[model samples]
Target: MKKILKYTLASLIAISLANCTSDFEDINTDPNGISNESLTQMNNHIGGSFTPMFLNVFNVTPAWNFQLQQNLLGDVYSGYMTPPTPFAGNVNNMTYSLVDGWNGFPWSDAYGSVMPFALDIKNAVALGGDASGEKFVHLANIIRVTAMHRVSDIYGPIRYTKFDDFETTGEYDSQSEAYQAFFTELGTAIDELKAFEDDAQFAPFDMSSLGGDIAMWRKFANSLRLRLAMRVVKVDPALASAEGEKSLSSDAGFLEATDMYINTGFAHPLTVISGSWGDVRMGAEMESILEGFDDGRKEVYFNPAEDPALAGAYKGIRMGIEIEAKGQYGAHSSIGSVVDSETMQWMSAAEVYFLRAEAALRGWSNAGTAQEHYENGVRASFGQHGVSGVDAYLADNVSTPNDFVDALNATNDIAYPSDVTIAYNTSGTNEEQLEQIITQKWIAMFPDGQEAWSEFRRTGYPRIFPVVVNNSGGTIDTDVQIRRINFVENEVNTNGDNVAIAVGYLNGPDNGGTRLWWDIDGSNF
Candidate 1:
């Protein structure tokens, strides 16, 4: 894979302006420092743009970038992991202080690395006048939605639909509007790619687990549609059901047997953050749930604690607690061999099964019964990790998440938030059944904390622990938890006028406490 060049703030602004301009020649002039004429040598004009889109979806290189882009926010908020280091003298994102400097990466990385390349593919294909090449545009759209939806989830309103329009270059889409656009784009991609299912033109540039098989790309698009469809179920149930059923009934199928992984040509970032730097460790919630369930995958996800007091135990640290130094909890479990490779998982077949399970719970058309899909989700996850005893694990109904015990500090420990059991709750309430499905989904989609955090906000399942110390100055509530991240400083500085208007689209003030459009604070039923 070609190295993705790092862009400074000025170049990123230049690229954004360049994208909005109407001149075709100006749009083709690569702002990424690659000459379009140079890229035409081997169809690299279109193919070359794909690598960055895949890499930036969940950045793998420059561990610090990934730390800021995901690990600091979603990974901590979702209860998957937390940093041992008390950044800024113990007042940081983990404590809800909402650092603007660190929070900007998710927005910047997506805009700089993902959106431009996708737009470039669309323009390059159109300028080439080869109708067959439209397939590349569709593929780029699928990847774009995959990346952009996470951005919209992070910050409620984003510059999406009107991004290419010169007049509305800095306009923002409300989360609802952005999601509607996602469904439309994903639907179009799934439909158009049907013609190119057997086309191998994408093989040379393919950096994903799909291996450039257009059929598999179609399946990924379909599965992604289901994900976005489920996301809006609370805010727009009718639209959710419509899109959900469409994906369920699509002939393109879903990610049933295989997972979607991007083979980033660089080392996985977690190896550096958790292993080399000792900056991140397992979270308290992970310890409670995995130990309570006697989950076999725990060993696969993290190594035993290195602290002499808890040696050989799978210990983890509680989030948002005061600590003078990293050494206090630095010896807690670090990440294991799961991220030892170059590939970063984007979506998994196990995740699709859980999505279908939720669709079934909601009575959507064509989805299998909740129990079957739920069990399949669990089994699929076990298979993905090559763990054994899945059948017994699935049948154990009495097991519940254990109470969290902070090894170094008893003050930070807490009881497990819920009594959600392992077995499928065949005779439970809709809320209970929903929790079962989502909790399993949460476990299945480990390490990909961006989606996990989004689902937690949407459904309130898996019962993540609240912060031990909220430093939000009352902007964020202790019990309510953080709903969404504030808009980045870069947007406010560069597109202040449009961002001022976008904040009005949010349900409340532009802070972490504001619930997004789909994060309705009500019953799932």
Candidate 2:
């Protein structure tokens, strides 16, 4: 990207971090209390960098940024949501036009807010003695990996594993290289963090739902490792299985029973985007599966349809369709109050269970039976949402994904392609079992569309609706759909050479048609 813009953004982030200085007014006679400068002087700068990174990843402010970075693109693409507004005369992302203006937010936000902060933390902690500050370094590494992996998932290649070197900072790592770095970083963090299991240095800087519990952070890190390992199972099964078994057997265990979340002081952006502004509503796939299973979590996930024509029913819009204005489908089911709450889910325990379920299907050691893990995943999700009747739902073997209907366009409708049910079929083939695991995992991971989108690209479970319009100018196939986002315009303008090299890493032209390194095209099973 532009060096000047990057430098300017870093300066702004430093100023923001300065404002987060801790209040120091204990027995110290200096009543003026510790100034921001003193906080940095006292080695508190390392922890200070974390607040901005955590808060900005799933950006808590200027709700429109979140709309562009995640809600509009991943949310729609993953079949979790669709927008009502006909942005730019309905030829936007919902219609597969790939809006250049909006597509840059995820990249810009990562490099501008998250990566810079993470770098500052690593640098600050590294300045201290290696043995003394190892814990802080590990913590920073964990946070860095957590934030950057999402960026790598968005656009195939990203500035990672080389961000610290000025000469190579602007260069990109291919998605596979980035994933390897993530594994390395997580491994380092997990190994070093175990040495400081009793340490509370992170507690003061902790703003996440983990609440400064270093052990819980370890659990989160291991769970993240498992999630990433599973992503590569199809592309590199041996490595995937090895990493998966390591995570499952780690002393710092997976995110079992409780998931990871961040309690940003502000209301979730979805509350504002989907509830207040009505810019987004439920996607048709969500409506089909949730309504089909008669899942009790539907009430927790969405409000009743507001359109008078479909009164009291849960309804959603198709991805790409002609719309004159937001008022057209704005009255459809609004996002439920669950997302509008105080915290944003980072990873769900339900997802961890499903990941283990897949590992079990692959016959990985310590993963338990697939059926047991699958049932636990569903039950865990129900408990997470405070929905009752899990036993009844798990026992019902007949419910299948209902056929999706577009009330506005008949051609947009499609039949339910799979007969996978909520109950586990012990005698089912590996492919059948895998689909069942992923489909529910898809449901359990609702509203966190980025992960869901990545898994969908990897496995093709819980079949999502194809866009009704092909606005890609023939770059992206209507059936295959958009695989990866093209590198943003900012990179083209300033880092043109590096962006071109990054395109070389892609399997096809630098467009939505190109698949990422881990996104194999054939059956995962």
Candidate 3:
């Protein structure tokens, strides 16, 4: 991990130098004239550092990087999408073979692209001693929490709190510890930014849909706090309640009207992956629920299958099935035009509503009611996608997910897991009501498989079908599903001792089967 940190900084410095080499040659004719202070004026150093951090959160460039960073992992695991192509002759992530080479992207992308830039901003601000600049650090902290939390969720323990210390940079914090830090940092950022709520310094560096509005960033932070708070309700109910209530009471408010999206200034990666490369397609679970409910957003989320046999119906492939070649499923649904823009969605207004819905279901303070929040989540999603017929869609309680049928292979088909309905179940049990909320949340949070996957592991709702094939060699259970990706090979090779200790923090072995600190077994309630 020390090497990892060094490489991160070295890479950042290389990029910085590469961008300014001509300026350096011209300005540094007299070496003494070019001081570190002088270089600060060369560009908006502090503000410029933020671009990579924001972009790397989802890794928008070079499509394949995004493919590994998220698509192959969270997107598939959440049952939102699957790749039609089978690399390694089908013994890949979908089959639970655990591709170490491919799995390292999530880790490397964060450490390489996100963490160093954030730390650079923090250090640059502190060294400058500008009280006005302190706001930048707070903002960076919020983004850090936003990006690193996903990394932490992917791998149980990560080097987070003490990452700045070179000597102990390799030491790992358990997921619980890292999550606690996330809450603390988010709370501090939210509170401190109140004084700078009207400050426009962040505007220039703002790549998100909020347009550098400090108040909106505070809302995003507060909403993020709410999300992390809800994540731990089952494991640490008291702390979860305290933090959740704090977020609810904050004047910064929650993401209600507009969703948070980062303008990466590149074509949406899914356009390439699903459209050009023919790699990814819609998942079976999406077809079951969306089609069964007669969801208006179904067309918004996916294109109809081009296979002439399916007669242009919206179709998706079941994951982890035997695939001799991509052609068998290549004509299935590709991604819809919703992601045809340059922006990558971070958090949806609908997701925040669904989080509130879960908080209400858990009987947290200030949470109005589960049904209200649940329905609002649906409406928000409907509005987000320009879908109509919400009233009729919400009234139909009899509709449940349709059983899946593989267009090419009967062996890959399965029954829809539950009788959960489109309408909120007021008379249902706590677990049943939770299923309804999470199922809706799952539907609403399309393409954001990272959060969706985490929610699925936490609450066990919207029951995903078991894989059609198991290839974990008994290390992972087909019924239990893949818990977390194995610790990356780079960590194992470069930071062996620390990685060993990190594995000890897991509930089981250091494999895809092991549950993280929050992924406890049994009832969500």
lDDT (C-alpha, whole model) for all candidates: 0.88, 0.84, 0.88
TM-score of every model versus the real structure: 0.93, 0.93, 0.94
Model 3 residue 195 CA deviation in Å? 0.3
lDDT of 3 by residue, 1-525 (tens): 577766665666667656643354544455445555545443367778899898999999999999999999999999999888988999999999999999999999888878887777776655444566788889989989999999988988998998876667778999999999999999999999999988887788899999989899999999999999988888898999999999988999999998999999999999999999999999999999999889999999999999998899999998899999989899999999888999999899999999999899888888889899999999999999999999999999899999999998888889997988988888999999999899999999998998899999998878888887889999989999988998989889988999999998888899998888988888987
Q: Count the backbone clashes (under 3 Å) in each candidate.
A: 0, 0, 0
In candidate 1 the C-alpha lDDT for residue 336 amounts to 87
lDDT of 1 by residue, 398-451 (tens): 999999988878899899979999999889999999999999999999889989
Question: Model 2 — which ten-residue stretch has the worst lDDT?
Answer: 20-29
Off by over 4 Å in 2: 1-43
Candidate 3, lDDT over the whole model: 0.88
For residues 346-387, what per-residue lDDT tens digits would candidate 2 score against the true structure? 899999999999999999899998989899999899999999
Question: Model 2: clashing residue pairs?
Answer: none
Model 2, residue 8: C-alpha shift (Å): 6.2
Native-referenced Cα lDDT, model 1: 0.88
